[model samples]
Target: EPEVTQTPSHQVTQMGQEVILRCVPISNHLYFYWYRQILGQKVEFLVSFYNNEISEKSEIFDDQFSVERPDGSNFTLKIRSTKLEDSAMYFCASSVGRSSYEQYFGPGTRLTVT
Candidate 1:
């Protein structure tokens, strides 16, 4: 079975700096999403993308955050300005359809803002 994959398993950046996290979701999936877990907190939804446009986004996905499928196989999350509170294990997930509850998640990219 195909699985989602993320780049730069870990990233460290200074506060206020920009960072882009990359991922490759299962090629056959139709819905892609970005989520983050702050330390011991629950997983929080950031944004969901479909057909080259944003399908849904949570409050956490403010102007500072953006997602894109720059190509046929790559999906990316960009944080315009990092803050200590932004540090977390960011996960990229994909599902076969919008209503599919079974999402495949990548190993995750750990982002640390200093």
Candidate 2:
């Protein structure tokens, strides 16, 4: 009965500021991912990480965005500069295997930018 956890459940920031969203996936999970959902939009995959390195990334994950596994249990996503378009609910997910495994998602971090 393990689940993902995120910090700063809600965040508000001015445009162009840097933001870091934190997540802790299920302790035994190996595959981690970052996804975002803009209001009224579909959930989109941004990046995936495994074995302390990035395994896959979408176009949405550009130079302005980055992900890191600072330690064994924590994963973080950092946005170098925030834009109005970046305002969305970011979700962290993890799975036990590369394919066919269920991905468990966190409650998400709602980011609002002005």
Candidate 3:
């Protein structure tokens, strides 16, 4: 079975620098989403994308953040300017459909901002 994969399992960046996290979900899946978990905090939904546009987003997804699918298989999240609060483990997930489907989560990319 195909599963989601992410690159650079861990990322370290300086505060105020731009960072891009990459993910490749199962080839056959249609819906994609992003979630983040700060150390010692609960997992929070960041955004969901479908058909090349954002379907839903949380307040955490502000002007400083963006998501894109540069290619058919790769979905990426970019932070225009990193803050200490942005440091967390970002997870990429996908499912066959958005409603009542089980989401498969990637191993996650840990972002450490100083």
Worst 10 residues of 2 by lDDT: 1-10
Q: What lDDT score belongs to each candidate, Candidate 1 first?
A: 0.96, 0.97, 0.96
For model 1, residues 16-102, the per-residue Cα lDDT tens digits are: 999999999999998999999999999999999999999999999999999989999999999999999999999999998877479
Two-way lDDT contest, 1 vs 2, winner: 2
Compute each candidate's TM-score over C-alphas: 0.97, 0.98, 0.98
Candidate 3 lDDT over residue span 1-114, tens digit each: 789999779999999999999999999899999999999999999999999999999999999999999999999999999999999999999999978999999999999999
Rank order (by lDDT, best first): 2, 3, 1
Name model 1 segments beyond 4 Å from true: none
Q: How accurate is candidate 2 locally (lDDT)?
A: 0.97
lDDT accuracy of residue 108 in candidate 1: 100
